[model samples]
Structures are given as structure tokens and as C-alpha cells.
Target: MTGKTTFEIFLATVPGLEAVLCDEVRHKGFRSPSVVPGGVTIRGGWPEVWRANLWVRGTSRVLARIDSFHVTHLAQLDHRARQVAWADILRPEVPFRVEATCATSRIYHAGAAAERITRAIHETIGAPHADNDDGVLVRARFDQNVCTLSVDTSGDLLHRRGHKEAVNRAPIRETMASLFLRQCGYSGQEPVVDPLCGSGTFILEAAEIAARLNPGRSRHFAFEKLATFDAEAWERMRTVKSERIPSVRFYGSDRDEGAVAMSEANAARAGITDFVTFARATISELQPPEGPVGLVIANPPYGTRIGDKKSLIPLYRALGQTLLARFSGWRVGIVTTESGLAHATGLPFLPPPAPVPHGGLRVTLFQTAPLP
Candidate 1:
């Protein structure tokens, strides 16, 4: 594999997260990234994929597209599976696994399909097959009468930054919060406050970005074990750093003291504790930083997984009144699975930009401008 090996990279995200994920990829310096429904597809070799795994903060998983073909039946699936140049993609010495999904095709038995694909790779490519339930997963999606094959370059979801030791009920994913922040036009230049800062995910994500910290710097990726992986090139790309430093405008507070402490610990682990302030304060008593215009972003509980909806209405109303009263000239972004709950904020607000699917639920990212 030489001469700028071209491979397909599939970036996966929750539904409606495509735009933000695309923006993050472009921000990380990918040239002409293309957006698809559930992800963005870009053409690059191992270097680009490696950098994506390291720098993209908004994506759920990064998959390298190795092969694809039309499969109407089990025999056709076996034939196409055997035809792929598996030796180029998988090393005979490395142990691997296969995962498959099928829809709208004659190959309806996903287990049998996966078994045939696995056998082909094992016999033809000489790659050892690992049992299911292993950490590493190879995903196969059969949709619209086409079979798409990809290898999960990310061992775990990218949002599991391994530093969040605790989580509150209805906690927001760090990646989702970061993408929502960007969608709200956060440039990290002004104060960012998360009032209902469960587990401190939003604040910590902002702090890390403001501090110019790479999200993947502390984690390992599956591509590191690939035969075509270039160690020296990966190290060089990983070592590239920006000279930007974080300011003290980032803050987070929660009514729950336990959440405040968890946010503090997460910030410390990410090495941005100095750039953020966490406090146990209710939304009614929340105060903006003493400065110019800034951003207030939060993923308040929606009574779906955690709290009582009837009880949370007061919290939402208080949040709305507090922001309207104290946060003039500042920008606000709120994420909630229930728009009706978000509407209780009661600020003269525009309709949400769009609703995005998150964790088997649909969430809308709502924004508002401070009054004159």
C-alpha cells in the first residue's frame, strides 16, 4: 500500500448530528469532507483516519470502509466477501471479529451472513477470527439493497473519554454537548456556563477545546494494530499542537453537589481544572460571569430517564426567568429530548434549529438571544 493509499472513512453520529460532525471534521482540517445521513464519508488513507480518530470531538465512531458489494442472496454474499483483498486490510496475525446488520435484502439471516463473511476472511485472508462479545467490533450494515463493510477504527465510542468516573441520571454525552456548543456558535472566547451541569460534560468539553487539548490524546485506537498502520506518521500527526491557551471564562454549576464534585474530578483528569469553575447552585440562583457577552449551554434533565416531569417544570421555568433577567446580551443553547419541557423556559425564543436523535430518543437543540 503506497502512493497515498485511498480508503473510505465513515464517521458515525446520532441522526441530526451529521452537520455538527461534518463541521468538526472540517474544523480539524479535512479537505472537502462529504456529509451523509448518519455520518460523513471522506477519502483518505491511514494518516487521515488516524488524525480523525485523534482530533474529531463530535463523532461517535470512526470506521474505515474496506469493501462493499451487492448481495441478493447468501451465495452472492459469500462470493463478494471472498473477492475482497482482505490481505491488504487485515493482517493474518491479528485477531479480529465480525458484526453484521441486514435490511431489505434476501440475506435476511444476519447471523448466517456474518458467519459466511467471517469464514471467507478466515480462509482466504488467513486472519484469525475472534469470538463475539470481544471489545473490538467490525460492523456490517445492509441497507437499501447494498452491503456496506467497515472496520471500527475506534475501539469504544469516542465520548467515553475514560475520565468521567461518575454520571447523573439523564447525563449528556460529552461529544453531543460539544457539537451542540459549536452549533450554538461557541468560539471559546467568552464565558460558557452550564446551569444543570450533570456530570460536567458540556463545561469540560468546552474547557478542553478552549485549552487546545486533543480529545484522543489520552486514548488508544483500533487502527494502531493494523498492518498498514504507520507508527512514525501517527506519532508525528499526534504531536502536532496548537499554541492556543484557555481563559477563565468557562464555568458549570448544578443544583446537585455530587454532580459538582464529579465535574471537578473530570476537569482535573482532562487537565483543565484551572480553566473552569464548578459550583452547587440552582438555576434560579445562577449568575453570569462578570464580563461581556458569553454563552450559556445546558442539557437539562427532561424527566425521561431521571427526574419527574411535573417537578422539573418549576426548574425549567426558574431557568428561563433567571436567564432572561441576568444573561442579557449573552447567547443560550439548551438541549432536551422534550421540546415542551424546553418551551417552559418561556423566553421569547425561536423554534429549535432541528431535532437530533440521541440515545434512542429525539432531542432538539434550542437557542435564544438575550433581550435588548
Candidate 2:
């Protein structure tokens, strides 16, 4: 039987930002969150699982490590799967799906392993299995003959904050955007600005954070479907509220009016419109808001998605000029795939972090400490 107060939990993240997610998890009070490949692992009960989904902005999803055992072959896998106490976690009336993967193991066929587990579940717990994409997912991975099982507790990726109803091509995922902000040393205390704010994701995130609003406040999680989930406790957990008088506001400007409008609508949906401003203007038109200088960050086009590198150099140059000329005291963070393009900005950035995979390209965030 699983302990009533604790369970194994993994916070999923992209490969490059494992340390970033780990920092966020530790800051959020998770017990002994350790960095692991493709994610972070923490041992906690259902409330900790729910809180991670709701409050930790850097994770892509939250996974509960439900069960595991050793199995050399399909028959052993089937026998062990049948003995697992599925009724302790899953409801017989609710449907689920299994996805199995095997590597360097005797049971090498993923489909056969999945079928065996599904049949066992049907016979043991009476919960019908559905297609993988549509229902609660039970993931089985057999690595080196050890079968491990987990359930995806966050259904839609946590990046889908459920508030951004509109976006343009190549919009950054909200989770990545939040991690980028944290990497930039933004604590939501100082003003933030995004010159190429495609859908105002950065601005909205900054505002909500400054106001002490939870990132998952407006959404639901897949854990709600599990038998261990307590609806009454979850309701109370989500209702825990905090309000802050933000220390400063956020600002964004984009050359495309359509992007500006989209950012505005997204901010309204997130209930952070009052703390942020979006205007249709070119990068050359960007000016610091009325406050102490803060961080100026942008996810400018990197030629792979929008245009030629030669064509974007002048745009980057103009951005560099604007910051150097008018915003002397502020810091800067730029995301781009091309080192040449980043050099084009002419800002004295520290060494770049390891490249992060985004939109099919390996991109890095080039950041500067406060400018002289």
C-alpha cells in the first residue's frame, strides 16, 4: 500500500532546463527534489503533486511514479501487472490508456507489453482501456528488464495555461517563457519589457507573478481523474489565495499590430491586463517605462522560422542601439539560435547557457547583467 502522505513524483522538463526546474521545485517546498534526465523527482503525496502542477511554472508536466517491478518476459510482466493494486489508484468507471516502451530488455516489443498490461487491468480492476491520446495515460517503460509504471498527472502540458486563446506562428511555450524569465534573474519585482512580444506571453506571465497569482489557477489537471485525488482538498488547495501590490508594471511592443492585439486579448484572459501594456510599435520605438530600469528581454525571430539571417541583422542592430542609447541601467536577455545574430546585437552578454531545444532548433538565451 502506498503511504497516505507521500508518493514518488517527477516534474517533467525539457532536457536543457533540468536545473532550472529543480531550483523552482526546491523553492516551492517539494521534499528532496532531485534533477533527473528529462525531469526532476520528488517524493510527496497527492497535495504536493497538485501544488506542483498549479504553482511550478517551469515544468512541462507532473508525473506520478505509480508502480514498478522486475520482469524478464511478457508473461512475468502480465502476472506482475495483474497483481498491482490498480483499484487503489484508478476508478473502475473511469477509462485509461497504457503506453509501453522497452529498451535493452527481454520484453522488447512495446505493443505486446502494452496489450498485456491493458488486459491485466481489464481483468483485475474492470477499467476499460482507451486510445492513448484521449484518456488517462499509464506509461510502462521497461529499461534493462525493470518495468516501471507512471501516470501523467498533468493532462494537457502545463504550458497550456488555458488562458491564451490566440497566438501567432512560432509563439514560445509559456513554460519555456517562465524559465527564461527566471534565468534572466527576474523576480517579478522590477519592470519587464518585451520588444517582440508576439502574444505577450512574457508580459502576462510577469504580471500574474508580480500579483502573486498561481500559474495553474484557471485550469484543471488529469490527477483529478485518479481515485487518490480528493476533490474537496483540491478545491481548497486551489482556493488558497494571495494578493500583492505589484512593485512595478510590465510593457511590450511589437511591429505587428495583430500580435499586439493578440497579446492584449491573452492578458485579459489571464486577468493581468491592468498590470501590463501592449502597443504596436517597432523595436526602434521601444522605450523604458516610467520606473527604475529592469530587465529587457525578447524572443526575436531567429531566421529559421521567419526570415533570412542577413535580413534580421539590421533588426538586431536597431535593438542593440535602442538599449545602449536609452536604457543604460537595464539588463537584457535575448533568445536566438544564431551566435552571429546574437553578436549582431552588440550587447555585452555573459557566456550563453547550453542550447535549449525549441521549435525544432537548438536555441540559447544570451543575457547581460545591468548595463553600464
Task: List, in order, the clash count of every candidate structure.
Answer: 0, 1
**Model 2 agreement with the true structure over 203-286: per-residue lDDT tens digits:** 888888789889999998889999989999999999988868798989999999999999999999998877888999987777
Error of 1 at 352 (Å): 0.9
Q: For model 1, where is the 10-residue window of minimal lDDT?
A: 131-140
The predictions' CA RMSDs to the true structure, in order, are: 2.1, 1.4
Candidate 2: worst-modelled 10 consecutive residues by lDDT: 1-10
**lDDT of each structure?**
0.82, 0.89
In candidate 1, which residue pairs clash? none
lDDT of 2 at 80: 93
lDDT of 1 by residue, 82-140 (tens): 88777776778888888899888777888998898889889996877885554346677
- Model 1: runs farther than 4 Å from truth? 1-4, 305-307
